[model samples]
Target: MFLRPEDAGTVTSPTLIEAAPNEQPVLSGGVTLTGWRKDGSNRLGLPAAAQGQVWVADVPMVGGRALAFRQLWVNGRKAVRARTPNDDNLPRLLTWDVDKQEAWITATAVGTLRQAGQLEMVLHQMWAVNVLRVKTLTVQGAKVRVTFHEPESKVQFEHPWPRPIINGKNGSSAFYLTNAVELLDQPGEWHYDGQRGQVLYWPRPGETMSSAHVVAPVLETLVQVSGSLDQPVAYVQFKGLTFAYTTWLRPSEQGHVPLQAGMYLLDGYSLQQPGTPDKAGLENQAWIGRPPAGVELAGVHHTRFERCQFLHMASAALDYQSSTHNDAVVGCTFRDVAGNGIQLGKFSDEGTETHLPYNPKDEREICTNELLENNLLTDCANEDWGCVGIAAGFVRNTTIRHNEVSQVPYTGISVGWGWTKTANCMRDNRVTANYIHHYAQHTYDVAGIYTLSAQPGTTITENRVEEIGQAPYVHDPDHWFYLYLDEGSAGITVQDNWCPAEKFLANANGPGNVWKNNGPMVANAIKQAAGLEPAYRDLLAEQIKKPAANGAQVKQ
Candidate 1:
């Protein structure tokens, strides 16, 4: 996701140096660009001299990771397709038309879009391209000028250049492409002091005595800032807004079971597509409700919880650890969870199960930098019965993608920590393409993507397991089997997955475990428990290309 072949500039006349070559036009990069113009208009970048439509309403929606388009010119050479709106089809919006260079694109074809009118270009090829929408945004004084209204669409804007702040606080602001639409239409008092470059406010909704300040919920205005420079907003979208109470109450001594997320903004919506269900997950339930015993919990960051649905929560419907980061709990759905639906570490009972074997001075640990992608868990545990769908330990570099665990009961995807000793506890974690199934058996452990006593580059890839047993014979399976390694853990890589094996099980050692190139019912017990022989089992049976199917699907 990096494109920069000579900063191509020029909407009708933006600039990067041009006077020759047919009124000076150069955008050659790979092409498939568009802004909007079939009578909609949006090719923004103004301030060199500013003009018209308030120069596209003073262009100001910027956030990054790639969603750039600048001088794209390609008219009759053909080869620039774009048409995808959801289902992860990928492609938000794009258009270009600088004096008849003619471009027309939508997004999500993957590659190919290089025209020849203004000289368009765009060769992404695949992967990485989240969401990039633009209504109108410009800042010539700080450079960010683009404007186009259909004539033809191509795209341009290359190399590290996407920074336009103005989210919310007092002096209201909203309009971001890379990310700007979490629910903030108005409210005031937000300043960045880099010489008046970032400011937001509205301050008149409820008047409020104005001293302690903090009122979030904007998408049609409701902001109230004070002064306290804070930054952590990559993407947030919550509509049907509701932000309440915020937390601060203490009275728990004899038997503590209290935790707080200290809500500032909960139940937010942001252009959520794919069969709409966001309103904090269908009909508002956004909460922060309990906090008293010492009060100090703040949650929700890098927000996005589509199709949100919850019930009876004890905690962790989506609790971002302390100083949150990179959060994304897409297509959410949880039910009757007394606790544990999506907890990326921290919010302790030391680690549930009523303090499990974990009892470190009452425990109140921390681990953030969250991400629980594509979620959906069901019937979580009740009455503090200990349930875990996605639980990390002292979290680090978290990423749990394409999720879909089922009828929860205990352990479906648990990583790191049996207690807190801490030392790079959970490093570079990634539990990808998940779809764990029916968990219920506990009484000790119910494994399926479970790792404990943490350590060693954890990565459990390409997951898919079936109805993990609950009875009949007490099945219970999944690697590391029962790791402890004196509570330090190590380099775990259980690759190319597909589960459902019940018979031979007995590797509770937990010392430097490795089961490389995994696939095919644990591939001969990971070569006889890492003793390795029989020519490494024909080199792990020639890397077992893909023959372990049983069940897994969320794809809705």
Candidate 2:
């Protein structure tokens, strides 16, 4: 029998309270829960409930093994399991100070006010959520002097920029401005002032504060099956469960400027740092770092997550880390996630050292034999722009096939990690039969399918990618490509792919890679390779069409 919190009546409903005049309502009275907090800090103790509640259950173990209970249902709807205090709604910016990188916003009077140290700023951009830190917020007469802590080097100004547009056009540039607490200026907007210990909100036009059913996320993970190298968690199956509302706590060291899709580590380092030899062999080299995922799996084997739903998460839905072998995430739906949908392995080239060791003959270790198939990943990378839909770093013998990924901020599928062609453990990874499109909407130097390093047995086949937009940087065109083999990558095969893009393929010093039967003209060949009968051609055609709802777009 599937055990659930509701089955035993362990879940409690949040207590609702009336809103003060001109303020938002408050929801309280939920139990506290504990788990691993974000920011890689120490494991959190029993934390107090914020806008959401928590439930704890004790199940009798059999033979000293813990029971696996993995679902949280709330009021008949499957509640999402998130990190902490979800940021589903963001207040609009009232005014801007482009020079100081500050913004003006208002907060309604409601609930417990967040302190300065507890608050973080999130800028909703097209395809990305730029998470920032509030340096100083000084309330003036009507507005707050909100100063951001971003380094001057990270900000893109109008003149004398490294890459300038000769046409004097208004490219998508990072912008911000200051704040203060006053009467709710607009509907569906909220503001929090730590100095006054107040949270204010302006409800949507037809919405009432008293009738609002708020569900804030208080948990970081719904299910975790961890084992050590000596004893692995093998042969576990998690099927037909919906996991939601995992949160990403704001880091203490703020000023997290994203290069793309909230991938902050990719901000400073460049593949083309002046003195460094151009490793990728591209005229312009812009590379960044990778982050962790929400559903972390380490030192486990033969695990399967089938027909699961992962939504409203603060980070990547699934992450397979060290010693994770022969795992599969099949027929799942990952939507509205803050990071990537699936992350396999870790990025090899981290820290200041740019060079990586070459081990052409070393056998694959840590991660192998993974399969990700028939999943729908959409509206991901909501908070981090640098993340992709499916990211594989230093993994071998992995298969990512028959998935549909769209409306993303950066690349759709990213494989391999090392910048140079130096051989690592990444090999024999296959990306096939997926439909990817409407991505690269915010940042730059990306594609529908992007690969790095020299993975000898990598093959990309029969995928359909289209409508990749350009980066916000200057001197770049308004469109990207379907495939990118970057930075000394080699021995890969790109075959029978249907890419109706202005540029079908790109290579950055990648050698010994083969491209066969690709581009729009090869659509029929791609269909045939993917085993789609002629009768199913129309269904495939419809699947390639852009989705109706592409989530929020960056306001020009």
lDDT of 1 by residue, 1-556 (tens): 1112122222343212212432312111122222211212222221121112110011123253222221111221111111211122222123333354322333222122111112112111110010122223333332233332221112212111111112212111111111111111223212111122222222333432222222211111011111111433323433221111111111111111111111111121222342222112222111122212101123324444443443223334444445445555555455544345665554334213211223234222334456676556665543222446666655667778666666665556777653222343356777776766676443123455666544557677666655654321111123222211222355666665656443112133245556544444545433222211232223212321111121111111
TM-score of 2: 0.65
Which residue segments of model 1 deviate by more than 4 Å? 1-133, 137-316, 320-341, 346-364, 367-393, 396-423, 427-454, 457-490, 493-497, 500-513, 516-518, 522-556
Error of 1 at 96 (Å): 11
Residue range 132-203, candidate 2, lDDT tens digits: 556666665455555556442244221111221222233333322212222123434333333333233333
Off by over 4 Å in 2: 1-130, 134-172, 176-185, 195-198, 251-253, 258-263, 266-292, 349-365, 469-475, 525-556
Candidates' TM-scores? 0.25, 0.65
Q: Candidate 2 — what's its lDDT? A: 0.54
RMSD of each candidate relative to the true structure: 26.1, 13.5
What are the Cα lDDT values of the candidates? Answer: 0.34, 0.54
Span of 10 residues, lowest total lDDT, candidate 2: 545-554
| Top model number, lDDT | 2
